[model samples]
Every structure is written in C-alpha cells, then in structure tokens.
Target: MPSRSFVVLAEQAQARHDGRVQFRQVLIDAVKPAVDLVYPPRCPLCGTAIAQQKGLCAPCWSELIIPGEPCCTTCQRPFPADYSEAAMVCGPCMADPPRHDGIAAGTLYNHASRALVLSFKHGRRIALSRMLAPLIIAQLPQLEGEWLVVPVPLHWSRLWYRGFNQAALLAEHIAKATGQTLLVDGLRRTRRTQPLGGLGRKGRERMLSGSIRLHPRKSDVMKAAQVILVDDVLTSGATSDACVKALKRGGAKTVKIACFSRVLDEARGQNTAMPETKTPEA
Candidate 1:
C-alpha cells in the first residue's frame, strides 16, 4: 500500500545509517593502535608493564591463592590432606552447620589479594569490577537453575558517602558474565553499624543481628529462588552469615556467598582475630 518513492527513501536512509556505523567502527579501530603505542597496558595490581590490559604480572598472579577441590563441602576450605571422597565437610562445619549453603571465594586473603580489595573498596576503583568479577566466577560452582545475583546491600549513609556499592558493581558484571538475572536491591541494610573490624564472632553477630533484611519489593521474586549473594571480601563469616540469614528468611531456596577474597582460619594461622586489612561493614 505504501508509495514506491517512500520505500526507496527509507532504504537510502538505512544505508546511510549503516555506513556511518561502519565508518565510526573503522575510526575506533584505527585510533586504538596509536593509543596503545602511546600508553601501553600495564598490570593493574603491581603496575608492572604487561602485554595486555587488565591483566596481572606473573609474579603478582602467582601470589594469589586460588582454592580448589578437596575442600570442605560447607565452607569450601581446602582440606589439609588429599581426600578421595568427592564431597567432605570440615570438622567445624560438621560440629555446627552454617546457615548459608556454601562459600565460593576468588582467592584466599593474602598480601596480593588484600591490595586488590583495598583499591576496589576504599580507593573507588570501580573499573576493577571487570577484572575481579571473573575471579569469583571461576570459583563458582555450576549453578543448575536460574540464579539471582544479589549484592550485599550498603547502608544509605555509606552508599551516599562512597557514591557506589562495590559489591553491586561486581554483581552487575557477574550477572552479565553468567547470564543470570541481577537484583541490585534484593537486600537492604536496616541501619549503619560500626566498623566490624577487631570484633569477635559473637560481637560481630550481635552488631549485625538485625542490620540486614530483604527488600520488601523483592520478597516475591526471592521466594524459593536460588541466589548468589555477592561481597568484596569475606571476613569472620559474620557479615556473610547475617546476609544469608536474611535471604533464607525471605525464602531463598539456596543462597551461596561469592566473594573476591576470603579470610580463612588456617590462612590466619588459626587465630580467631582478623588481619590488619580494612573490613567494610556489611
């Protein structure tokens, strides 16, 4: 029913649009090599020059401790000796089961991972999400069904001060990487609590007892849903435990804690106290 002249004009416009898009891409391709020559990519962590961008140097990469199988089924901590069984829970977990399903950590807390955490959190290196999210993803177990990616919420006060939630940033990347739905406001902080550093497990528990809860609007979606609760670091297991409890109360079928770094008791020489690195309140 349309006129032939109108059809021809529309086709011409589309061809022009496609040509512009191709020209823009060609320009970008041409400029990228010049930009790389002027400013070569370097290691994000150690500042050592590297062949590619957003990659770590060999020495810095080696310093990171990536935990693998032969780990506790509940906490995912590597066992002391090689065990034949496919699944094994540690003695501590056997004695008292954890509320959350399990923990998947990118790396064990160490000097190298510590620097990454510090820069991502306090230094506001938001771009690091692209580099850091993959580490957590590599450690994540194969998720069966649809899983919701939820970041541990930041208090309004802290969120306002920092201008961004590092966990949420990581969750955004994780959701995209895994093709999972992201619920940025799945959880909410009830109030701002004191810095949880230097606190014992019991002390941290008390401080965070009612500090986190499910966002009211997301309660329906959370019901019986699988969730990946994200955080930058896992220390003392107190904050993460609290978040898990909140998700469980919201009827989340299984809530797995995924983090960039995990502070392990064995890594701490079995000391109960946390290390000197700064720990942000959950």
Candidate 2:
C-alpha cells in the first residue's frame, strides 16, 4: 500500500492534470463559436451581413472611393484632371516638405470611408481592419528598402480610457498581410497634446510638435530600417508629421506614412475648419 504522503502527492498530480484537460476543453468550446461567426461576418461600416469572411459585401466594396490616378505622391491627395504625372506632389508638400519620404493611403476620407473609420475608432469596430489591410498592402510595391511598420502611438491616458489603440490594431493587420515586421513601440506620445481636430493648420502643428518620443531600445531597429507610419485617419497630417520627425530623429533611414483614409482638402469646409473648443489634457 502507498504511504500517506505518497498518496497525497499522487492525488495532487492527478487533480492538476484533470484541471488542465478541463481548461483546454473550455478554451476549445469558447473559440469554436467565434471562428464560426467570423466565416459569415457583418460589415464594419454599414452593419450589413456579409457572406465572406473579413470583407464587405461586393456592392459595398465597389462603392468605396479608393484613391486612383493623379494623386499627390507626398500627401496622397487627388489632383485635378489637368495633372497627369504618376507622382504628383501636392502644393503644400512642394512648398513645405514633410520629413517622411512618401505617403500612401487606401481611400479618401469621404462620407463612405468616414463611416468605416468612425466605426473603427469610436465604435470599437476592430474587425474593419481586415478589410482595410489588403488595400494598404496593395501600395507596398511603392515602398522601398527594409521597412518597419510603426503605428502612431496613443497617449497612455487615452489608451487606458479606450482599452485599445486602433492604430496599433490596424498596423498589426497590415504587418501580418505584408509579412513586414511591426515595431509598435518604436514611437510613443510622451505628453498628451490638445486634440488636432478642429484646430487650424498652425495650431494643429503646434499641438503635435515635440509630443512624440522614440523608444530607446528601438534605436537600433530605427537606424537599420526604413519605417512606415500607420494610422487610421489622416486629417491635417500634423500628427503623422510629428511621428515622422521623431522617427527620423531617432535615426530611421526613411519614413513613409500610410493610413486607411485621408481627409480631402475640399472637405475642410469653413464650418469644420475651427478646432474643437475644449479637450481634456493629460
């Protein structure tokens, strides 16, 4: 017969093994429904049901106004019909050059695209990134050299409030699709600045200046590789410019900006030109 101590040890070991088995079973059961649901998913923009996984229905996908020919290479702005160059730089870019080498965006941030961006940023519709990633990947041929993917960092306070960084999520998806390395911690917003929305161009630039800091450990990676800054939206470009400046200062060989949407110049009407009246400070 076994001694008392030996019996206790055996019982404890058996209990641990049983617990592990039960935990694994629970995990399997929990994940099965999620996998099934993803196969026939709902559209992130319109909430319409989709038959395929990780995509909008065919009609909604077709309706998206993807950026086409005659766009500014630096800013990705649509140019007038008279402009015929494949790499047309916008007037602002020509006048005041950005630190980054180039900009690539998936779509114009018009009413249709805004719906998807708002859902992802405000409504926590993270699944929308699946649809957007491929669009970003299509622009990868335009990128050159050994590139690292860096998402625009959210201030820690805002990150805590939202429980997630939408840009990071989008960057992760893009990284996965393109097989590019993602350096999420390369840049961080050390001091929370005023909201860029509603601010005039100068105010927006001022708010972003000196707001971002590059991570110390990522210095080596930044030095060795080109970088692609990722974000969900591009409004005045001030925020991205700040990130680009920080990355370059940290020794990034080159930097480019990519986003799901870019705000059109014409869309910045008089009513929306004013910055928000007030925002919480960090």
In candidate 2, the residue pairs with backbone N, CA or C atoms under 3 Å apart (3 or more residues apart, or in different chains) clash, namely: 198-274, 198-275, 199-275
lDDT of each: 0.87, 0.77
Q: lDDT (0-100) at residue 72 of candidate 1?
A: 92
RMSD of each: 5.1, 8.8
* Residue-level lDDT tens digits of model 2 in 1-282: 999999999999999999999999999888867876765567665668766446777777877778876778776777877887666688887898878787788887666677777666776777777778778767655555557889999999989877788889889988877778998898989997766766667898888778898998888778857888998877778788888889888888788788887777677773433122222331
List clash counts for every candidate, in order: 0, 3
Task: Look at candidate 2 and tell me the lDDT of residue 164.
Answer: 85
lDDT per residue as tens, model 1, 86-172: 778888898889998989999988888888888888778788888889999999999898999999999999998888999999999
- The residue-level lDDT of candidate 2 at 100 comes to 79
Report the alpha-carbon TM-score of model 1 versus the true structure.
0.85
Candidate 1's C-alpha runs over 4 A off are 1-31, 34-39, 269-282
Measured against the true structure, the TM-scores of the candidates, in listed sequence, are 0.85, 0.78
